[model samples]
Target: MPLSSRLPILLACVVALGGCAGHPKGVMSPVAVSNKTGGSKVDMLVVTSRVPSDDPATLFTGERSPHPYLTDISVSIPSDSKRKAGTVQWPKKLPPNPDTDFAVTRVQQLKSVDQGRTWFRAHVVGGHALVFVHGFNNRYEDSVFRFAQIIHDSGAKVTPILFTWPSRASLFDYNYDKESTNYSRVAFEQTLRTLANDPNVKDITVMAHSMGTWLAMESLRQMAIRDGRVAPKIDNVILASPDIDVDVFARQWTEMGEKRPKFTIFVSQDDRALAASRFISGDVQRLGAINPADEPYRSKLEQAGITVIDLTKVKGGDSLNHGKFAESPQIVQLIGQRLVTGQTLTDSNVSLGQGVTAVIAGGV
Candidate 1:
């Protein structure tokens, strides 16, 4: 089924599984799980919330406390090699607080650890650590699991860490979602700083999607300004389907200066959601939705030593524009593989061919 049509059904399934059990008022709702396999079980966390839909600015101005909704979750993955179904259940609601904590209820050891087709304890043995920032309307578990799948499928050896900010998860509250993105910036930076201080983590790569890109850039900017240098621990930054204003992003990039990472951006001219973003921001020129065929922003980003991947022609899902990274297996593989190896893709890896392409002329 088309992803657009499939979204409602998937959401209904998530709700019907009773994952919202014991949800606190004015906080995030819980996720429901339906396990087809009655095998070993483990606990996870879920959060849900509600907000006004029409305006994007409302998200930031709301008086809502910045407290994360916590829950105890149980997940059951099939034990049989042939079975591939499982369910996740959220059992209790947690109090609102600035500090969040998780106590693993139970864990089931996987029989085999092939790609992310199965679940296992996430451990970073030797590779770099990757921190993923999800776009608007994403729950903690959804982001983590999706990224885990990508990381595993790409055969990346790095530990995957999800930096989940609070999301209302309602289509109606576009403004509220934007506000939450802004509110989470400080917290996101704290997490990065903490990770940078860790001895076990050798290098870090940040993958921020949609509005999450704003948070990532802001956090990085803060880190750089504070230390007077880009945190050497961080290696790369990936922005996929960023929803920021092109002018705003340009200013941000300019401020970043030499502190920037080996940056990569995935843009598509066909992204419809970005069209809406352009209307909302009233900007005729935008970077996130640039047409690779025209290569308008490619030159600028390349000059900044940022790699641009134009996936406008890559075909796969109905939500093609919205979920190119997660839905497209090839894109996922490329990101996972490169991130795992800590390889910085340059013009050579992209094969610009003969004359100077916009990406090459721009500087990348």
Candidate 2:
């Protein structure tokens, strides 16, 4: 059936699945992240194009903004839970509970920095920063805790930053999210350029998931086009289950020339979420769900020198199989061990488990 006819059904399905158990809300924790190096409390920096809520009752809302803003925050994970990547356990309690085990605290604006150094000097070092651009339907609080979770789980020693574009935070808002991703490209570009040019930041690793991958690609391509060169400090580009048209991805890459960062794409053929996205996109295969073993897709990725990993067989805790990159322990361990080290995911250098397969740029 056509999407027009199935729109109501799709919306209903989305609403049913939109419930996130143990999602964080309200006032953040006041505990200092300095208490533990890799302990429960984690400090995270936020860069967002979402408009701040006018009412003080709400810090930020699901509205889009013309300009970008930066914030620093501290998020605390449950002490009983493991700090492993690809794993998340929400507190037993629901919202409106101040005593909830997990909290996001200590949020302050980055008003000034001494000689380009962030307020959290311990987190920023060796000129390294890790930026995570979130996927579709994420709200302000969602992005903050997610990035904090990622930073804590990955054991990354660099500064943790999250770039949040405005999301309608609704299951039925797919079209709106797509347009919002495009609309936030300018602010995203500005954030990247600022990080790249900062003397305190020697290099930056960017990770984008779902629709954020589309925005990230467009922003980087636009930056390259306008500046006549890409930033060398933009070292690693990791896309997790990208919900983008393969053809558009190729065009974005082609426009960047040969100076772009090493590309790592995480794909899964069993991603039902991408299947829905493909349906919505008029049956155009999403870049994340393409089978690397197949023709055309494999050939195109090889030609473009993009590293594609096939994680279809890996059984994840998440039922959708869409967020394995951040929800699978094995993949998260792999990311922590290899990808974050600024190492290339070439055939000769990579190690894979029984289910995971690596398709290098030079061929299988």
Candidate 3:
């Protein structure tokens, strides 16, 4: 109950953001574009609700923008042999070697909806699009690079779109980041509506992690209330390490109407980031840290027809265990092949888990 007691919990979250010290934030260097080394490339369309920054490298700051901004970012990922799957190899310095680190190759600002449409025609394939919402404490470049790695490693053949909100990207600004989600909820809803209304988009998957999951769900809930149902074209939803309170998510799900997208959640009971989140959120359990086999949750998720994957036992990536969904090879591949592609993960597809336990709705 005391502030002193909460300090320790707050410090735990600092671990997630403390690692990137002394590095320049959001730098896009042309140097990486010259890389002839055999690596991979991922170009993504970005939509943001942060204030534009004067610094070109830091295109957007954590301050809420009056309107959304759009850009296209390209990141160069090292060769498969050089880097491990499911990890963003952050560059140590500017003008990074594309062969050794993830580097930004290009940054182009979009002035109008026509430009965004052009990008979709040029890059989107098979009428499939995957929109990614990054977690709290992420810079513009952080989301860009991380999503690039996910696309490159998972080998998902779809248009990649990133939706980023104002996150100070500091451990101390958790409340600000939480409020920012609410501020951007309408904008995010508009984004999904645009994608759903687009004639070129047939199948859509929305992948959101941590606090972004809260934003995603809220936006969808608003859409459900306004449009009578979530967009039919956006049929798959993946929530990874969601930082939302379990009880709150239940209410959100209820408001989403019967025509909601199929939901799949990646949970890890041992996630320390969520442990901190729980402390800040009045000691309520976060959706991402719930035990899929536990009481209430098990029966509730089953009745709701939601798939749950328990990643507590799965190892490797993010010592805090908050990013297993993206950091695990099997999990990322499953996301690309199953969830993102709109294929239901049935018992036959359980092999994709590799070793992580998966519980399909209706008790798999």
Candidate 4:
């Protein structure tokens, strides 16, 4: 059979096998794996219904839910025997907790304190806290490690916290992943409230990627509505390549009331992934993927007190337009040096290291 024809068969098989397992009774337990070198290993635990249905897949792709969970996860690190270099491994499957009513998964141990050199849970000192929400198809370890690298590379004093939802970790399960993202909203909000209430936490900055942006916005909107304030103790809200309907974002922003973040949105016209997203959504434009050079949404966002960064001309790694957060050193530096410092980069100060035009708010 042709690969195209065989694809459905493979998907059916996966769904059948997944559905065979019964729903877990409670929250999944954390699975811990240790490396002999006393370094760190990454692992993932997933609590999901054994019976796979089209529901999860539908939720991810259809935008039925903005957040999704990776029902399964894996973590790896170098083995002790090969100190110089070897692959990480997991010995056993972590069971789900019978007490809690939700499925859970723990990905891995990040032991790198000096950035991404090695994984270590360093003591979080002072300064504000920056929370990151990863988008669809990301495993827990992937999100944590990437953000760790970004934080380390930026040399920002803020403590970084990652909110990992359950993602199916498959391209086909887009709707399922989106459903998971929606399901994780409450947990995300709880995390925000916890950090915001922390006396040591000076301010809160939330940076969400792709579909996670919906979850982030919804959580903030809910919080603001409940509190009747738009600027709820938070400082910055950065949305990177948000996979949301432009109209929906506008409505959400309006409903968020007073507790809005000092908003910053990053956009790129050449993001192929977003192009695919646009196609999947029937060509409805997304604010995060709009080109500031041409899209009027740039001016609209600026008028609404949201700063938009156009990275279409900026080149870097990750062909899928996924790694822009960590790829552009200049962008990262600007984010750390200015936004984190409670300052916005004006057009004159915004330089991309070339003769290219700087990012001007409202085109100056």
CA lDDT of each prediction against the hidden true structure: 0.56, 0.75, 0.86, 0.58
What ranges in model 4 sit over 4 Å off? 1-122, 354-364
- How far off is residue 64 in model 1, in Å? 5.8
Question: Candidate 4 lDDT, tens digit per residue, 149-255?
Answer: 45644666766666666776566776777777777777677667866665556787888898889889988887788778644568888888889989899999999
Candidate 3: residue pairs that collide? none
For all predicted structures, in order, the TM-scores are 0.67, 0.89, 0.95, 0.67
Q: How close is candidate 3 to the true structure, as a TM-score?
A: 0.95
For all the candidates, what are their Cα RMSDs to the real structure?
A: 11.1, 3.2, 2.0, 10.5
Question: Whole-model lDDT for model 2 versus the true structure?
Answer: 0.75
Give per-residue lDDT, candidate 3, residue 292.
Answer: 87
Model 2 CA lDDT for position 43:
77
lDDT by residue for model 1 (97-216), tens? 211211122322222213121221245446477778888666444554455445544556666666666665554456777887777776677667766776666888888898788888
Q: Candidate 1 — worst ten consecutive residues by lDDT sum?
A: 96-105
Residue 299 of model 1: what lDDT?
61
* Candidates arranged by lDDT, highest first: 3, 2, 4, 1
Clashes of each: 24, 5, 0, 46
